[model samples]
Target: MDLAALGDCLGTSSCLIFQTVGGLKIGLLMFLVASGLTLIFGVLGVINFAHGSFYMLGAYLAWQTMALTDNFYLAVLAAALGVGLFGVLFERGFMSRVYRGDVLVQILLCYAFILILDDLVIIVWGEEFLSSLGIPDAFHRPPLFVGGAIVPVFHLFIIGFSTLVAVALWLFMTRTKWGKITRAAEQNPLMVSALGINTSLLFAGIFALGSLLAGLGGALAASERSISSGMGFSVVLESFIVTVIGGMGSIGGAFVAALLIGMTRSFGAIGFPLFTDGLMFVLMCLVLVLRPQGLMGRSGG
Candidate 1:
């Protein structure tokens, strides 16, 4: 453990701010991805193994959208919309059947989708890395000086934007009619059905909404990271860790857990590089052992 790198990260206020802000951005981004996974499980009661594939699809779709239109906003919109549409179709065509099915059945269906989606990505984008996407000029204008620390504008935007999204999601889940209905459906699908609610469509919509979140995360991340064939796999693994730590089916838990993981990794890069990758795993294990429910999740789930 060399303290040199750690000191470099903490030696100056600006360095500390930059690292801290970066951690927030990473955490929020993780929240966006994992929220969808948790939502699907919460409402549909199925562990979607194919969620990562949808995330990968969003990146490719965004790259293609930018390549063709050269518009930043459109690229983001397209990624979310395209993946969302695909999610709807996928849920209707395949996943809907497996609702409340055997765990193995769910896993098998999702695993098959992973292979199919991976092959599709290769066929569409070629087996090469994509790095053409650039930060939008509007978002690249100028860095913000905060508390004597210069922070990238894009980083601030992400933090603020993600906060807004999280708030909006919370509002939707707690206040909206559909949101209330969704919760009802989650709590008692039989009762919801008895009340003349079409649970099948509701499930499909919930699943698509989850896909949309994952897609948006990928699109947002496109500029920061290289778009590639298997980018989603690593993200999905971290997202699973987030879900587990946050509590499965708990969106609020996911948000906080993502931040914790992000900060752990970001600072770990400076002070504990050797243990960076394993830190989250250790955290996950501890949470599992000490509080199996999660930071914000309900017990017996």
Candidate 2:
């Protein structure tokens, strides 16, 4: 507790360790949002500008579900499943037709979806910022102290849950039959079809998975920030930055990029209060200039 000792700690690796942990938390959330975006783009070949809207829906749904059910666990499940089902409908009824269309057209359609979704949210949620779902009251547990720092149980849950999701995704993609077929479709849709795989169903599955990730991210973020109509638009840009920096089609790339960006933004915000919002973009530009395909992306694929 001595001031001199504290100063020494702050000036050395201890400060970096704290920053890294904080950054890792941010990176985990970014991964949740960007992972879905990357998968949808990599597999379905859709720009999906409205991915952030799905995140917004998840937050709103969490608010509504918590109010109705008064159970955080149930609210999270309902939010994820509801958003995922909506994604399935969106993909099948609308995005399916534009699978192989021009990239600009896809972006236009997604942008339109964004407008429609925003209006729908206003109509349903009434354009007011809802308070944080009162997670502290809901959990009512003692804080976990890490090196004298108070850590919220909800954040611990996010870290554990995201890790589980990542592991499950890795196992599914590498060990399961459905995952193999999906990866094949990502590589060569025509070849996959020639091998007797139904690409349509596979695409639908991927879309659902992507939406599920977005929904989880939204639900988790709602615990940190009030649910608002504009939150999606604000966070989506950060998610896009993570996806681009990580690589479009590589889940591993997304994970790494998310952590890097998360740490950069966290430390940058603390060390350089000015331009905190633009730190991630600056890093993205630097990475792109050095490695156009992203940190883990395949070039000319």
Candidate 3:
């Protein structure tokens, strides 16, 4: 065994720290995207294939808005709100009619939406890699050194923002009456509906909220990365992996899985460069063999 190769694989203390921070940043973004997918599945019992398209839509909208207004905050806000509202419309116009249909119908509807949304993006954005220069200069500032490891300020910002959102979501779910009702509906939709709660409105709200989270993820990413068509599809694939590993309809599971995946991706490149791409798939297979319901998922989930 070559010592130099071993050392490179293990990485230095500073390199490890840098990778850890990078993992955290990626995990935060994954959580944001997966949260909505899990929420939608948990509440509506629908596996949304088009959730990622909404994320892509958010990034495009953010770029367009920022180009017009030259305001990063405003652009992000607008993108999230716009995509969320579109979700509401989509649920009302198409999804409501098929809520009671078979799973195939739901899948087809969402898949169709994905195609439609993709074409729309091409029409609007013209299929090029949009530059991220529209984002404010503040986001491109210098990095911070922790124990001699370099950490980008923007990545830290993402981690902090995601943490804050997670906390707020927890408080909302545990403390607010509406949030409590939503949770109850997730567990027992029939009971809630039979008790006079408007299930349609509840479902719409859940879908819209989930879409909003996805959009927020896209908006946050738009400033730092090059945007293009099919971006949503790529994110949705990873989001599906996170949701699967976390367990369908399990928010806490999604959070934990996101971090696990983030760290895996960050370190796998160093430790097992040749197998990094298949690492998650291998992990997913193992998890399935041991616990088909996922790490934090309930039985049959």
Q: Quick one: best lDDT, which candidate?
A: 1
Assess every candidate by TM-score. 0.95, 0.93, 0.94
lDDT of 1 by residue, 1-301 (tens): 6579888778888779978998999999999999999999889888877888888899889999999999988998999999999999999999888776888998999888898889888888888888947888898777888867778898888889888989999999999999999889878889999999988889889989999999999998886789888788888888999999999899999999999999988888888889988888999999999999999888884
Ten-residue region with minimum lDDT total, candidate 1: 1-10
Candidate that beats the other on TM-score, 2 or 3, i.e. the better one: 3
lDDT of 2 by residue, 1-301 (tens): 2445445546766565666667778889889988999988888878678999999999889889999988887777888898899999999998998877888878888888899998898888887778876674645788666666556666777778888888898899899999888788888889998988888888898999999889988988787778877678867888888888988888989999998888777677666557666778888998889988899888886
Candidate 3 clash pair list: none
**How many clashes does each candidate structure show, in the order listed?**
0, 0, 0
Q: Candidate 1: lDDT of 64?
A: 95
Ranking by lDDT: 1, 3, 2
Computed on alpha carbons, the lDDT of every model, listed in order, comes to: 0.89, 0.83, 0.87
- RMSD (CA, Å), candidate 2 to true, equals 3.2
Off by over 4 Å in 1: 2-12
Candidate 3, superposed: residue stretches over 4 Å from native: 1-11, 133-135
Candidate with better lDDT, 1 vs 3: 1
